[model samples]
Target: MKKALTTIFCCILLISMLSIVEASSHRRDIYDYKGSSTGFAREKVNYSLFNAENFTGTRMDLTGNSSADSFIGKFFGTFFNWIIGSTSQSYLSFNGTDLDFNETFLNGTIDTRAIAVNATMKLYVDAQDIVFNDSLKSYTDAQDIVFNNSLKSYLDAQDITFNDSLKAYSDITFVNITGDTMTGDLIVPNLTATNNITITNNLDIGGNMTLGEKITFAFGEVIDNIVNGVIQITGDLLVTGNVNATKFFGTYNWTEDSPLLSFDDTTLSFDYAGLNSSYDSRYLNLTGTNANQNLNVSPFNITANEFFGDINATFVKIALGSGSPTIDQMQEYLDNTGSSGFFTGGIISDGGSGTIDITAGQGFIRTTADDNAPLLSFNWSAQTGVAVTDNTTQYVFVDDTGTISLNSNEFLEAQDNIILGLATDEDGTIESVFNLGVRLEESIGQAGRFIRRIHSVSRDVRRGGLVFGETGTRNITLTAGHLWWGRTEY
Candidate 1:
């Protein structure tokens, strides 16, 4: 009985396993093989039908030489090699920083419509012409486009303006220059003669220009100009302003009015012919050697050490020789000397044969003070040509005042009348004085007798009596004569 049961269980389990395998096989066969052998063939592939022309999908026709296939195979081979981390190159190679072309050149023109380069780009080509239709801005390290080892010229259509300053390294010459207006200052630091610059038309400098070297005007004349330094010209100079020079040599002929001073040859004449008056108010000064200089006209005030011509003046005053005399001293000297007229100062001494004759007026000689004695002593002989007299002859010494005594060797002799007490008052009136004379008159009836004139009459007479007395003690002494009081007694 246990064998029968074991055989039955085995049969059931096999049936169920077979069922699961059959279902799985059917689903796979329907989905994978389209459920039949007639829907799918199991033969070998036809290689001739698998060509690029026969296929309607995106395809590439390989050349007769199979270049496309060779290129694709080579590209895949290089890609696989690069995926394996290899640096081996077939055409292009990149060694981390540089892409090398491996000395191969591109033959065709590459039209890159727009390109941007973050780093510096360099083209190592010869004879390349690059043109730009739009603007070209260079933002290099120096902010400049430098054409190395070449000369370049620029032709600007509009205004080529510099926002800051514009500098030129070499000389620039304008060949076909038109109207160029520079609104700013053009600075040239070192301009040599080899560096030449040419410009046409008018050059108007609005600012101050300093010239370090000498400037020469070869042909044209300079008008409305001033030269600060000394100017020497070969031509004539006509100055409209005043010329102040230290020394000037020229000849001038003036034809104006009022010619006060004139120079002719070696003579400087001050002609007052054009003046309104005899004296001119202008001053004439002469300097230098006075010996050779001559003044043709006389000036009002002249200062000189010596005068050559005659001087006529109403009064002549001479300075004193000695001492610095004041006005008071001069007045005292004039007053004491009693010389109040002209020729006030001088000493006139006649050492030669000269005489001071006073024929017209009365001559008076008196001492200034009373301490000086007045004496009139004469020692003149009747001899001619006697400069001095000898003291042997008697001279009458008369004392006009005080007591008079006669010398034993001298005698008084009167030529005319010897009148005593003859005086003149302030009114110039002559007064009566004691007159002792021998007057033989017909009215007096006296002859050869001494008479006294009193009121034009003879009153008291004492013959043979001598009057001897002083000023207040007069006494009469009679030897043998009678004295009458009111008449003459003989």
Candidate 2:
């Protein structure tokens, strides 16, 4: 019994020694401790035997070369169940060179040849991916594409190529293409119809191009020149430039159309070579010399210094010089009613010493003919300073019926002395006896002097008679002389 107890005791001591060895083999370092809990502490002590360096260097390297039988026999023991078709371990092989993954990661540089999807493919490049392909022809899987590049030459002919099956949509906005010339014809397919088409360069519209609407050239905008077929406008045309048209026509078709011409507060100058018109009339025609002529329409309120014209109207008002215009028989035929008249403000004439034969109906005022033809005839030579005073308080009979009565209070005064006579008939015979009177007042050496005289003459069926009488007082001391008088009558 003592021997049996000694054997059991020895077995118990061996089991304790194995437990100590197991514990020592799994003893963890400070860095290997994941946690301090009971379960985690046990795992940490077990896993401490396989450190990163030892597992990678010694354990995995040895296991990678060992056969399955020897590997299991050495490490896992005889009771270890085999995992079928599995190697003891596997390792990555590197021969002191860069390890190229032949298979690209999602963040690695892509081989364009490897970009193949059955349908439309969209490959998005990340920031870490740097493409190295000089020519982009290797990417053939996408239906639509968008690329962002900093270099402009990347889209040049050498860098990019197109597939005939693919449709390209390129947009390079905010890119300026200045100072570049294009040679071929450019065709834009989907532009709508408009009134104006603007191009930066000169455009040549080929063939007989037809426009659907009217073309308007705005004011202050210039068109260099136009070579056209025909421009037809369905409305009014306003032209400010020199027009070279085959024909021009205008008509008053609207009810609100004004006259063809209108004048502002300005002058209209007709400098044409000649003017012609039909069925024209005017209210006033003030014509003058052609060189410096002015056809003034309204001269009523004009303040100019001089005016010249042959003013023919209902009444002419002359503001400056004047003369008596004769209306001869021919002029009378031309103007039957004498409506064409000249009424001047003032008139002065110097018709020498001969008698001025002022015909009937001719005077400053409007006149008409009658039986007593009171024609004015002035003989300046025989009428020098003639003083004729009709101061009698009696009525003078000019003809058998016509009589002129003088004012009793007023007398006609003349500066000089002259004989009085009447207008003669066709036989140069005096036609009537006109009553007359004479008075003289003078100053001799500054003293007042008065002289009065009276005369009476009558022509009748018998021989006419003449009587003379005088009575007055003079301030000067004078002696009287014999006075003689003569009278003649028919």
Candidate 2: which stretches are off by over 4 Å? 1-210, 213-230, 249-490
lDDT of model 1, residue 114:
22
- Which one is best on lDDT? 1
Question: Estimated TM-score per prediction?
Answer: 0.21, 0.18
Cα lDDT tens digits for candidate 1, 357-415: 11111111223223222212111111112121222221212222212222223224232
Q: How close is candidate 2 to the true structure, as a TM-score?
A: 0.18
lDDT of 2 by residue, 223-267 (tens): 333346544454555666987968644442333222433333243
Cand. 1 Cα-lDDT: 0.35
**Which sections of candidate 1 miss by over 4 Å?**
1-230, 250-257, 261-299, 302-469, 474-490
In model 1, what are the clashing residue pairs, if there are any? none
Q: Which pairs, if any, clash in model 2?
A: none
What is the C-alpha local distance difference test score of each model? 0.35, 0.33
Model 1 RMSD, rounded to 1 decimal: 31.6
